[model samples]
Target: MGATPEEGAAESAAALDEVAESLVSLWSLAHNAPDVPVPATQLRVLFILEHGPVNVSNLAAEMGALVSSASRLCDRLEAAGLLLRDHGRDRREVTVRLSTDGQALLDRLKVRRRDDLARVLDTMSSPARAALIWGLAQFRDAAKADKGPGSAGESFSLPA
Candidate 1:
């Protein structure tokens, strides 16, 4: 007899909490390193937009934020020239995209983040780096399972 299902779930949850904390800490550190003029929330919005233009409601859902709060964040980002709101073909729907300045800022940030990560990875052994990648992939796959069907992992063929 092995551990009960409840015990397994508890262990999984604990692991997830650790991973989440680590992600948040790393993201906070990297995001704040440049001291960009935009607020963190606005930068988050821009990050989402980099994937593609999206409606306010959908973006809010993805960000796990209230629609109103997302709207306010969008307003601030737009005012800061980081985002642009365009009328959809339906006219009733509005789509948000990163503006030219926003793209430029994102590009700069991406380069800086890549440089930082490269520096860190350089200090890690190849096996250690591989293990870290594998662990993160597993974590991402487990998170997608919790999100139900058709999440990001479903689109790719993962090793068994």
Candidate 2:
């Protein structure tokens, strides 16, 4: 008999996790070959900032961290010229944005990572590469449709 739908999903999710780990390892190797300017935690902050400017509390919530810790991270990134902090629409609030240099850094890293991934993909059979692309497109569409725990409104908490 064929696997149940839930079993197939679990197997696919597990495989995707391994793929994600490999990709992360590849990115880390490529990112650090030239010495990354920011710590991993701060890099994550920059990634979140890439979406848009956010205040400390929201950023902290997204990172599952305390506001004080997030502020300290921003302080470090700001000191390194990778982040900017400005007054928010509310007089008492401060918002953080990635600086131009930070964006450039991200852009360069993306190029390098893509080049590396492309090299790996080049070694694969044509059919395998085509399958990978098709699978990834379908997975992306599924992810966009889910809007579950990872959605912005949940902010780290899963639905009951």
Candidate 3:
């Protein structure tokens, strides 16, 4: 008899964690390269901004950081020409949007990351690569199904 779907998912969770760890390691190394314009946290802010403008308070919540901390992060990014802050409808409210430079930087970082992963994928057997591609698509489908509407899971996708 086959394992129940829940049991199968439970068994896969640890393996998923291992894969996530390895990918994070790769991302950290690539993100910290000397030429990369921003640190990881700032890059995260930039990525979030790339989606669209966000209110200062909401950005803080998204990052799980205090409003002051989020504002400080925005300060550095704005100083670096990576983003713009504007007063929202209420004069006291602040909103942030990624600058053109920030978008370019994010694009470069993504390309670098893809290249790094491609290098690793290049060394794998064709069959292994095929299996990985198929497995990841299935996993993505299942994950999307499990997530509620407008959840961050929607933001997670394999690069083309």
Candidate 4:
């Protein structure tokens, strides 16, 4: 037997609520993480820079933020010695890249976060972990297909 339309709708709504609550919990955990002094926004900027040096305007576009806002974020990261800005080959453009300290910090944070996640996952059954990995992979693929290259919306999704 199939579920009624109303039942299906209710289930979907409940799933969305659960996802929202999980996101809040994740944010709280990240906020309380040790040795991670930067705000989440700055961390995201550093993560992007870690991939490769990008021009300020491009970074702003990718982050979906105003140029001035991105500039302010860059300034804060630079002040923390986590990023470097240098003149581009065009001389008129500025390129932003992560500094060694930035890389070190990111690496440490990644490891710590991975360990924290692993600890939580350890309590779950293997099948549950596999299901999570599979679900997230499918969600990522769907998101990438929906949003073109350089789109930021790939970060959020709900599993069906």
Q: What is the lDDT of residue 97 in candidate 4?
A: 97
Q: Model 4: how far is 15 from its true place, Å?
A: 1.2
RMSD (Å) per prediction: 5.0, 4.5, 3.3, 4.3
Per-residue lDDT for 67-111 in model 2, tens only? 999999999999999989999677689999999998887777778
Query: lDDT for model 1, on a 0 to 1 scale?
Result: 0.79
Query: How do the residues 75-100 of candidate 3 rate in per-residue lDDT, one tens digit apiece?
Result: 99999999999996767899999988
**Which ten-residue region of model 3 has the weakest summed lDDT?**
151-160
True lDDT of residue 159, candidate 3: 36
Q: What TM-score does model 1 achieve against the real structure?
A: 0.73
Residue 134 lDDT in model 2?
95
Q: Which ten residues in a row have the lowest lDDT in candidate 1?
A: 151-160
Candidate 4: how many backbone clashes? 0
The local lDDT score (0 to 100) that residue 90 gets in candidate 2 is 75
Q: What is the clash count for each candidate, in the order shown?
A: 0, 0, 0, 0
In order of appearance, the predictions have TM-scores of 0.73, 0.81, 0.79, 0.79
lDDT of 3 at 132: 89
